[model samples]
Target: MNESWMNEVSARLASLAAANPARDFEKNARGLLSSAFARLDLVTREEFDVQSQVLARAREKLAALEARVAELEATAAGRVK
Candidate 1:
């Protein structure tokens, strides 16, 4: 939110751009932009890790449901025999 902080970031990015002569300028610029945006408080790696674990559990539950559906279908077809 502070203009001075933004200016400082801009200056640092400019320095990075000048120093990295062998890298892609656009990619480096985008990375700098991302870093600046990330300066604001955001989710930490630990929080993201927790969410990833939750998603994995949900996916496992979904797979079990799909397998159960297949088994039910098989049972229903057999009953029609």
Candidate 2:
């Protein structure tokens, strides 16, 4: 019986706290921060990760092309000699 009473009291306290001004302040602060963050240019982690992968692939291709060009230049030089 005592445990049940304590639980009920705790629940009422929680319900009251939820309606308190501090809760409203917290909600308003969260909204303000969300609005400010939304106004800035930002990419999601998924987008940043995808773009990083794309850049890595592009770098690999460029390196392969450079190596191929160097190999061709060497072959051309050997032929001239």
Candidate 3:
């Protein structure tokens, strides 16, 4: 039904692209995009997620350390009173 129609259209398009200059244009476009992307600083989703988790853990540890320091300072001030 609809699936067979799509398959036939895809086959026709593939045949036309193979025999046409469109194939070379598509290749050149992909190469240009890849070159541009390579020139930019970028991270994969997995790397970004890992770094985000690391930063979150560091923040939590920093908060705990700050609380500990505040408690120690208060205890010292009470003794000095």
Candidate 4:
């Protein structure tokens, strides 16, 4: 929803910029920055946050597994001793 509004505004701004000589430099600079950013293949902030949450969950799982392994190893060692 927000993305749609942003795209709409960007389109309108581009159209207005086309005939505005005063903003020629700003327009060119904006064009260059956008293209450069596009080429970088960056993800949106929302996507990053989602991935961060996933990674955190994964880390929690890993820690639990590690602890279980340690407990199992300790039990086995006690039996041998």
In terms of lDDT, the best-performing candidate is: 1
Give the Å shift of residue 11 in candidate 1: 7.0
Query: What C-alpha lDDT values do all the predictions have?
Result: 0.87, 0.76, 0.77, 0.80
Candidate 3, position 55, lDDT:
100
> In order, how many clashes per candidate?
0, 0, 0, 0
Give Cα distance to truth, residue 8, candidate 2, Å: 43
Error of 2 at 25 (Å): 1.3
| Candidate 1 error regions (>4 Å) | 1-35, 38-42
**Model 2 C-alpha lDDT per residue in residues 11-44, reported as the tens digit of each score:** 6556655776887756755665566557566789
Query: Which candidate leads in TM-score?
Result: 3
Q: Write the per-residue lDDT of candidate 4 for residues 1-81, one digit (tens) a residue.
A: 357756865775676677677568477657756875676689999999999999999999999999999999999999999
Off by over 4 Å in 2: 1-20
Supply the TM-score for candidate 1. Answer: 0.51
**TM-scores of all candidate predictions against the true structure:** 0.51, 0.62, 0.72, 0.64
What is the TM-score of candidate 4? 0.64
lDDT of 1 by residue, 1-81 (tens): 899988987897788778877467677888877887788868989999999999999999999999999999999999999
Which residue pairs in candidate 4 collide? none
Better of 3 and 4 by lDDT: 4
In terms of lDDT, the poorest run of 10 residues in model 2 is 8-17
lDDT of 3 by residue, 13-73 (tens): 5766677698675775566556655656688999999999999999999999999999999
lDDT ranking from best candidate downward:
1, 4, 3, 2
